[model samples]
Target: MAKGYIEFDYEFCKGCELCIQACPVNTLVLTTKMNKKGYRLVEDAEGKCTGCASCALVCPDAVITVYRQKKAS
Candidate 1:
């Protein structure tokens, strides 16, 4: 199995929840934190991101970056 995580460009996020909905692992959630633009933030609740890039692909603001651990040969 692959392991991965996501980083959010917090300031650019509009709290649209698109990334949350696009996440296949259901690890994404809304947080109490707010961006400079006053939009609520999303977080990887369980650290279970699969680096699928689904979230990033769906983000209208392009705020998400997914990073995966390289598999050992």
Candidate 2:
């Protein structure tokens, strides 16, 4: 089960593939399709991110946004 979700701003993403390479957990992947700007944007591997936010920190384009899971009530 997923603990959180990550959003990728394809508009701002330069498609440099830095996020893909920087992911320690191998959570990021480069899709075959390009973004609106015709750039290959980075995508998060579903159910893979540990909420470590490594991709968010290393993103040069600052397009990765990680939302962590909320605490139990």
Q: Pick the candidate with the highest lDDT.
A: 1
| Poorest 10 consecutive residues by lDDT, candidate 2 | 41-50
| Candidate 2 Cα errors over 4 Å, as ranges | none
Candidate 1 C-alpha lDDT tens digits along 1-73: 6999899999999999988888888999999999898999999989998899999999999999989999898
How far residue 24's Cα lies from its native spot in candidate 1, in Å, is: 0.7
Say which candidate scores most in TM-score: 1
Q: For model 1, what is the error of residue 10's alpha carbon versus the real structure, in angstroms, after optimal superposition?
A: 0.3
Candidate 2 residue-wise lDDT at 35? 72
Across residues 1-73, which tens digit of lDDT does each residue of candidate 2 receive?
A: 4366688877898888877787777867778878778988677756687676777898877888889887778
How far residue 4's Cα lies from its native spot in candidate 2, in Å, is: 2.8
Error of 2 at 65 (Å): 1.0
Q: TM-scores across all candidates?
A: 0.96, 0.80
Off by over 4 Å in 1: none
lDDT of 1 at 5: 88
